[model samples]
Target: MSIQAASNSEKPPQEDNYQPPSSLSSLPDDVVLNCLARVPRSDDLNISCVSKTLRSLVRSPELCRLRSRLPKKSLYLFYHFHQDSKRCHWITLRRGEKMITSTHDYQVEQRSCSLAGLLTSPHFPTFYSSGVSVGSEIYFPDHGWPFPSTKVRVLDTRSGTIRMVPSMKVARWAHKKAMGVVDGKIYVIGGTYGKNQVEVLDPETQTWEFAGEEKVQCNSRFSAPLEDKVYMVDLEHGRISAYSPREGINNVATERLIEHMNCMCVVENVIYACFKRSGLMWFDTKLKVWRRLIDSGGKATLCSFNAGKMAEYEGKLAVFWTQINTNFVEKVDIRCRIIALDRVGEEIRGKIESSGSVATCSYSITLSHCLVVSD
Candidate 1:
């Protein structure tokens, strides 16, 4: 026996047969591009880290154009808390699948669920005014404060990018003013105390012009986008008004006084306004009348903590609000719920679509703003 010991440097037999896992690059260029287009906009950052090919695809403008054509739609709720802090915490709530019960009724839990993403960059200016969502973009017009110059900040929800656009011609903040999108243009109505000006900005042209000054100033809290015009509620005058780019502002004289309305949103040409004490009400443009829908139940939970906000989520009206419980020791649980509503004749039914909660030492959580954007 010559004691022929195997050389220490000899490689294992299995090592020679090993192969690397397949990568996205192995697929055809078009196939890979289509796959990347399907990824959620918020997950683009993570997907780009997979490989060099994917990194290139994600950053290309062509990818964005392709994504816009995809049939899939995602609903996102963006809200901000803590207005006094220098850095505002922006949380994003994604609309999740509804859970069906044994009785065939859909139940949306009233709790705080997992967050889709968070934005706390200093670049995100604090906005006391409501934001208008155009397609996949949300425009926040900041009140001229720490900085003298007034400018509009645009957040591309699809790409998770934020940029500052040209300053408004009037250099006025949207404080207590109405902002909405109509006919591919952004209309900012009302202004600081005693300033009744209507400014409209065309994103395509990147220019702002005064729409017109009418006697009826728009109530910021009760205005929303409807078809080709913007529908607004004149609580003081006990009437509803519609502003058309071609015909100017015209009031729909009515006896319904919407002064107590806390928030409003438009769905399927119907204007839904939520009153703190009266629950939900819908304004019929065809009938020119305000009708009461469902009484205050789960819908009222949104306004229980602070003033709730409403947005259209996939053709349905969605309301978001916070609830605080102080039973725990040294910790307060703040529950957030998103309620979705369905239209059935004059009756509007609601279900809790998503719920999440967070425990903190603070007694209550205040929701300063809310917006719904499609991705």
Candidate 2:
């Protein structure tokens, strides 16, 4: 009896010592990365806290490459508000799975993503200045206004870390300045009051170099990088100029594309510009011609009170417009329209795939700046 009792005690101890399988930890690095890549980037902060391996994977370059392949698309909107003081917030809008009907019709739903501690950093910039995003980082030029100081604020979307990077060679506020990122270098075309100079910054080295001086006056308020060249729109002259590091600035196209452009974004190597009254127009770099994109049955019409901003989202052009009403109880109505482009014969045309009002807010909300970033 004593021997049997001792054997039972030993069996119970052996059972207690047995460990369960760690399915996740045992997964291959690639498999683990593939799984984590599908997760929303906004949740990376909390996801990384799970373990050291996960934290490293979240910051790994391979994971970013995997994320770029995932079918799910996320559009992050960064907006600045200032009623009494300067403040900014990042709102993530994700496109839900497409539902198809038996009639061969489909619908895309846009929903706000839950982001916790993503934009809560104290170092986030509050001022509304011109900015550009390259890879996973966004750079904002902060030339001390009223007082000349050279400083650039850089925001890393992955970890939600905002830090000040090396300033530009010259102290220039990004307001009304032409900025573009090419070949991993940030080029800033400065010199208001008729003097045009080009400065380039290498983020890798955290250094700035003078690219060259532009012969033509770069008075454009918007600039975007396409392929190897940078396109700058001259609203005053109704011309678009292409700048290359090897070659100087050259006028590519000219059109009276309205006196003022609300915002501009590049999609599929073509530049699209939005006007307050004239509607939407695009510039064809291949033909060096400007053509009006008809709204195809009033799909994109702007009111006098509507303020519109355009951005390239997942190879499609997205326009976000907000109408503010002082008399109405509802202060602002934010509307978004996604346009998909297709070639109808020889002419390229866009059709509105999805359109709806995304959100509404009180009158106290002041949208100073907006930019779309993919996560």
Candidate 3:
């Protein structure tokens, strides 16, 4: 009993079991990278917080190349259910590694995650062009949405600088599917009170001119461009045709395709459709018939479930679908699948590389419009 040394101030005893944490740096960069490559991307953000060394490693290009073990497709999804919950979901389609029970074979299970609230309500783009090839440069009217203007402003994707470009021949703009990019110019369908006139702008010369007066009338609100041709699908008219920018030929084909398909897209000069009943299908240009999609595991069940929309990403087919809960009071689940294609003569095989859920919303949302985008 050291009564003389027993002062009020005292420090807690150190636990002998405590030791400094191990560092990944202790391991070789290649070894660390190999271990990290197996980690789920969802956990990467958290792992980056562990140490400064890890932060650099996780964000490094080396990790990116390694993490890209399988097919990679970045998907942007917009769902408008209510004005209050105005948020956009960004989904990352990545490969997940899993070892089978006792076999050496590995399974790539895609856990599609939606990063919600990525965009605000005011800044959220009210884009109507379903087939527009809008690049990193975000273009809008000199004024904001719902306001018609001839002047167009573009935001530099790299610098994020917004500047006004030349005005169009027609003072027309709208959110109801009005704009499209063709060739090296911007074209405005210009939705001018019953007029079919379109104004074209050349970004290189900074000039605006009128396109052909006899524009093709398309019933589809969505369109997809294949090479030099812009393909439009008219479900009501039961027609899928390719609209030529310079010529009047639409190359109307697949009258039956529009009947079964709800959404369609083109990849590698091939038109693929999501049949309302048939899951996934692609049109045979030579035979003029629809073919089934095969999953990567050599299963035909890839398109067995109903899919909503189809888009091509990174030279692959991306399919989206929603299933209504039979117990109507529950939430609905919206999902997406990316399928890789291999064409051999008349037959096309679709291998589903990854799948994920985009959103979960209430069934009360009777009329919900989903717009899917990929880059």
Candidate 4:
């Protein structure tokens, strides 16, 4: 249903001179602002749809007082596609931006330069994967197994200047599986590194340090830079944990063990984690509890929602699945229909959207040693 229709159906009671309930009516504006800060980005939009008064309150810049407490701009990711044609292109998507749009394609000039320069070659998972930026450098690690021989390079995208940076001396660091930045340090976590180790890189000094071995089971996906913590998933066992440097780089298992967590993403401070077997796991940082999202599951087979390949787009959690037969990539936003936390797992709620070309082969792999760009 359209947002307008949904709002009209739940029209709030209107009193001639309605004073909201004493609880809400008497709340200081600042107190109300704190409540709004805890709401997920999508729910804030729903508040805009609820009523004129609420819409105004939620949209006001005054509500952003808590956002200023954040240390950095919400992370922006640019996924590059360097097809096998010796050409490279990129699309930049900021977490707060509305959409991902194609930009420009740059040519791969060197055969032995950084991995981004190897786009024209036929090595799979070369320059495509989720990555984060620290200072002027962006790191893209190999996503698949038997990690390719790569050289780490930092790029001045503006000047198209590429310079080699510190790389893991050991091979297959799972450099592509997941990456995050915390306290000015870069953490490269699990993929296919032999025995699974977390590789920490300091961009300021151009150096690399081996933090420790990854504890989660192999093939279990993990995500980092969620609030003050980095999360690791025991996918096969349905367990979860977070890493905090304040405590040490060691993985500290969470008291809440969620099963089958195949896909994970963070919005604001909460982690929206999805499991293939049990459905969606809603982790509230403030409450320190597990609220199962039951409404977002069930239709996975019909929706072609694989519990992998999810990305946050424009402040909404987008789940992506590839259709092999049609060579299509599809996405769904589960935020708009979230009525309660338990529904995150039980209902197949939200609008499903798809994009990209029919040819899946026309893709780019961002490698740890190379950068992938898409136009």
Candidate 5:
């Protein structure tokens, strides 16, 4: 939803006839403006109908300024039915913006549910599990594990819609976090048959070309982008490799260990890894050591991330996970949590700001990705 920004020079018009409630209008202007910024645009019509004071607040330029300052951490969940590959379903884990559309190959349905978000995928959970979001688009190679292809699919987070782009010239067999964006271009970390080949995609032209191959130690299923370079971690040998395409440098490895990691992503230049059994961990590039994540209370957080996916949301860490509902008939619950992170000297702390189930579904589902997009 879009709202025209009111000029900052003019103050919100005061109501000459209808007076607003004293409890609200009595507050300081800046505080009132911040509250108005949090109000959903979908309710603008209702807010206008309520009172003239409210309408002026909605149209105030200060509202836009405060809203822009607020972090826009829109979280989208990607999943499809267990029996279909011709379709992908993307659902937002927040409340508001209900949309339903269908493309030639995929069916798009999105609703920000106050309860839980739903997604289904029969595409095998072992591969094609998650995607990397670049701005408004999320890129995933057509390869669905066990099978490799040159095709690619892109999802738009604005309406929870998805579509297929032109196929890449070379098939990318990489899975999981093998895709990242550098300088606005989508980069796939691995090439056909686990080679160190990289494929670059220009979203504007919907075209792809192969990048110079780097001497990577092994075929990594997951990779991350940081500081203009891509990183691949090999925990078996305690090596976290960094590759620089801009500088044409092969990735340098530091000491780190990760095993059974469900997903890993970069947040504030730190690489956070989530395990199914273990809670959360981050790689310390400065000390070249791996540390378990600590909460604000200086204690380890007990979070079971079984088949979980994570992304950066609103300048904070957003965690998504799925669990089978035991009390009811075969059903799945998609859960979400927002974590505010803090740094104290050498230790990084995390505090879960909010936690709840976003959606519950009757059908068994496999979560493919959890993406955080800006509004």
Candidate 6:
């Protein structure tokens, strides 16, 4: 059978060449994935690594439902390094893009976690934690000192999967604690739990109840999730409260603001306060009034901007930064940048500033929920 192997078994395959590229020619795979999600997060991470129709249009969910019907989309930056063996870094920005497109389309997903097995108490540990995504799940809780027995965790950011809940009798933890997601329940406000504790968690019944603990504290100054109401701000002592767990443990403190607040959110229904170093407020829940608007340069030093790890992405208000312990060989080049705040434009003042300052910092931020799409 040798004639170059019998003409290679009589070569019986040849369809006059090839032709397969017309799915109606050009656009229309959901409009080429909404023009590649408005491209520019460094060319959508290099066209999601080219080929495969652009890694299925850069991991599409109908391109996140056509970027939630566009009001402006693309901004995902999550960087956590309050290390105990946990590291995080994410980036995606396409709203008038350019902060060097987040240091050139950032993406460094890592995992080797352990905030001490998420704490049961290494004598109370957890000095900075905040997260709340819900729906695809992402809830966080844990603030430490010589006090932090109340812990909370519920992540499935897609499926890094984890569930641990139980801690709301107040054990202390408030350097800026505030979380909200009313209806499916998850309202935790006014940290430093030794006195102003208001907690609630029910990620479909993982339970961690207790909603009442605030008889006046200095750190009850940040908690927002409007619609069913859940706004708490103290600004040191100018107050601003509103809670309604389907109308039960009612609370409605008010003293108004004078300034010096530094973090808050409630988008769409409005209640965004960011008096970072001083300046920016907008609370009008049906005219309670406090409009100031923009000005965060009074003293400037928004403490690495971590308003409970703020997030309203695609519609603006994306925040991240809490991990600076430099000089352990420069903490391996310490780099975390995810701040895209411009839902309607106002405060991005001095344009991206945050360099150093972390005294006695302990951290943990886990928001695992990844499925790209494959049913």
Best by TM-score: 5
List lDDT for all candidates, in order.
0.60, 0.65, 0.54, 0.47, 0.64, 0.49
- Per-residue lDDT for 16-36 in model 6, tens only? 355666652256677677776
Clash counts for all predictions: 8, 0, 0, 34, 11, 11
lDDT of 1: 0.60
Q: What is the lDDT of residue 265 in candidate 1?
A: 80
- Worst ten-residue run, lDDT, model 6? 366-375
Number of the top-ranking candidate, with lDDT as the measure: 2
The full ranking of all candidates by lDDT, starting with the best, is 2, 5, 1, 3, 6, 4
lDDT for residue 207 in candidate 2, whole number 0-100: 89
CA error at residue 375 for candidate 5, angstroms: 3.9
Worst 10 residues of 2 by lDDT: 101-110
TM-score of 4: 0.50
| TM value for model 6 | 0.26
Q: For model 2, how does the per-residue alpha-carbon lDDT over 318-340 read when each residue is reduced to its tens digit? A: 77776665567957756667777
Query: Which runs of model 5 end up more than 4 angstroms from their true locations?
Result: 1-61, 64-73, 94-130, 159-161, 194-196, 213-218, 234-239, 248-258, 305-307
Cα shift from native, residue 117, model 6 (Å): 28
Write the residue-wise lDDT of candidate 4 on 115-173 in tens digits.
45433234423333445556545565533344433344455544544555655654443
lDDT of each residue in 84-195, candidate 5, tens digit only: 5545555664433452221111122354211112112225223443366777777766544555566666666665555668877664454533566788787766544444
The model with the greater TM-score, 1 or 5, is 5
Give the TM-score of each candidate. 0.62, 0.67, 0.56, 0.50, 0.70, 0.26
After superposition, which runs of candidate 1 have C-alpha atoms over 4 Å from their true positions? 1-84, 95-128, 145-149, 159-161, 192-197, 212-219, 235-239, 256-259, 295-307, 327-364
RMSD of 5: 13.0
